[model samples]
Target: MRNIRFLVVIYLICQNTLFAQNNPFYNQWEPSPKEGAFQMEDYIVWGGSVIKGEDGLYYMFASRWPKHLGMSAWVTNSEIVLAVADKPEGPFSFKKVVLPARGKQYWDGMMTHNPNIHYHDGKYILFYIGLNYEFDQPEKVGATRELYEEAWNHKRIGVAVADSPFGPWKRMDAPILQPRPGKWDGAIISNPAPVIHEDGSVLLIYKSAPVPYPARNQNRTMNFGVATASHYWGPYERKGEDNQIKLLPISSDVEDPYIWYDGSKYHMLAKCMNEAITGESGAGFLASSEDGLVWKTSENPIAYSRNITFSNGEKVNLPKLERPQVLIQNGQPSHVYFACRNPEGQIFNMVRPLRRNQ
Candidate 1:
């Protein structure tokens, strides 16, 4: 009986593995192009989103901070900038600063990070997390944990709109999403991922914590919540029980989600924080939902890995690869983007092409 039971378990595991391998999206990764990387000599480049402009140009809204201040300074010093390319995958060139530090008086005054670009109703929408603190910009020497705590807890999700990607972006004076006072999202909201419908309705998934940062312990987990807005601009309301949309079945370690719709259903790709879901922490996982609220893990959940293969047949393992954004063109995912870092703390954005189903 013991042997029979063991064999049954083994067979189930094998079946699951086979199912995972069958995923259309997971099986479509092409080697990333070396020239597709976007980096600056004196800046730390992070994640970005790309959209095809009406002028037939590709525009990427990405985050960057001074290299001297280090990556952690993203909480206090980062700004949203625009990069343009002739093709979807390029050696993109910096165009201009789209969202800079306006003033400490406003909620998103100090920093703007994790931009996700979208188009709805003939307008360009940029969603991102912004923060402000009482302290001045830290020197190259680095920021204290206390300062990080102060800046981080103020983090809120906001949006900017413009007629074109080359925009005089009208940034909101108030945040579009704020934390609940004593709920699962009591602490803060960051990492806005939205799928905009043809009618301009938005289904947004965002990261939240029960308690403020630096106060979280082993029991505290970073989770995701879903919100819907009838129109992209107005009153957004949380969905699901306590607004906690269960994107992952096993754990709350997933974050930096990128969501999109492919005509029928919603699909998401996010960083697997630990080894629970993907068995490789920091690798990305894939999930899908018939309805936006009830999400299920993909049969083969692994989306991408930190071990990168270049188009020229070279391979390198990166230390950190987070904040994934998929560029959807002609009703399919064409390229995947990421914020990658080396052991020495150098940061840059990368793009990998995907094989389209013929």
Candidate 2:
């Protein structure tokens, strides 16, 4: 009877391993050179979220501004827009600009960018970055790097709540995460990567840098930081401020972290900005943490690269790909979504796969 039971346990472990394949990464990828409705001849689109709606359609929450406004506009004049698609790899149609610059009096009056949408606490919560400041050059299409650098240093993470994916988001009076006065993130904090658990705990991994020395924009000591809260929206406190959660070495940094908690641990995918994972710039890497505070790079840390090939056997090397997000469907990673750049206009999506063969 003991030997029979032992054989059954061994068989069960083998069966489960076969089903999961012992690999959670790798998948098919497709790209639309120019994306969705808002890709006007004069508009620039950047970071976003693509989620399946309860209505059986796909909704993308993204950031955009005019090409005439110049790239720097992302830090000064960008807003969160909504678009819909029938399929995950879409010719997504622009629906509306959901979060716009309210007014100078508001903290997010200048720009609202980096939208990460999640459903928790019986509502849809929009995690994003907000920048606010006073400026007089309305007629000018763009600002100088010095001007943008000043505005960007004030960026903070904010959240908006809505009953449904479609509408009526209520934002707070101020940002939820602010830069600590004398820490690594003392100058700026943005690019929110949030994972909301069933028990209502929220884990947010975001980007940050220390105070500037010679000038604000010249410093490039950007790295990842961790914060957690009992509720989806917080009162979030930074976890490793004193030691700093430096996943990579002090010489290298990671950004655009998308975190998810499997049953046993926390996992993340982020842009390997400094050749830390793949020994190349503009690559994607995967990592995990048992406790959601300290992280370890996967043995095969390089997940994908900016240069990608499709399942159709066609390939093209992209100049840039950033802001990686995984859409979880039915307790598994379904689709990999991210932003790509083109000369004609910016693409709000790269349209990738998450399965081994796609």
User: Roughly what TM-score does model 2 have, to 2 decimal places?
Assistant: 0.86
- Per-residue lDDT of model 2, residues 1-358, tens digit only: 9999999999998965553433355333443323332354556777668778778888888888877777777888788988888877666778888898898888888889989988875688899999887774243674666677667877989999898776788988888777876777878878888888898888888888887433544767777888888987688887874635656422366788888877888778788777767777988877777877777774556667777665555566777788887877776666667777654445545567555342
Clashes of each: 2, 3
TM-score of each: 0.91, 0.86
Off by over 4 Å in 2: 1-23, 27-41, 137-139, 212-214, 241-243, 246-251, 310-313, 343-348, 356-358
The worst-scoring run of ten residues by lDDT in candidate 1 lies at 16-25
Give candidate 1 misplaced runs (Cα > 4 Å).
Answer: 1-22, 217-220
Measured by lDDT, the strongest candidate is 1
Which residue pairs in model 2 clash with each other? 27-355, 28-353, 28-358
Model 1, C-alpha of 142: deviation from truth (Å): 2.0
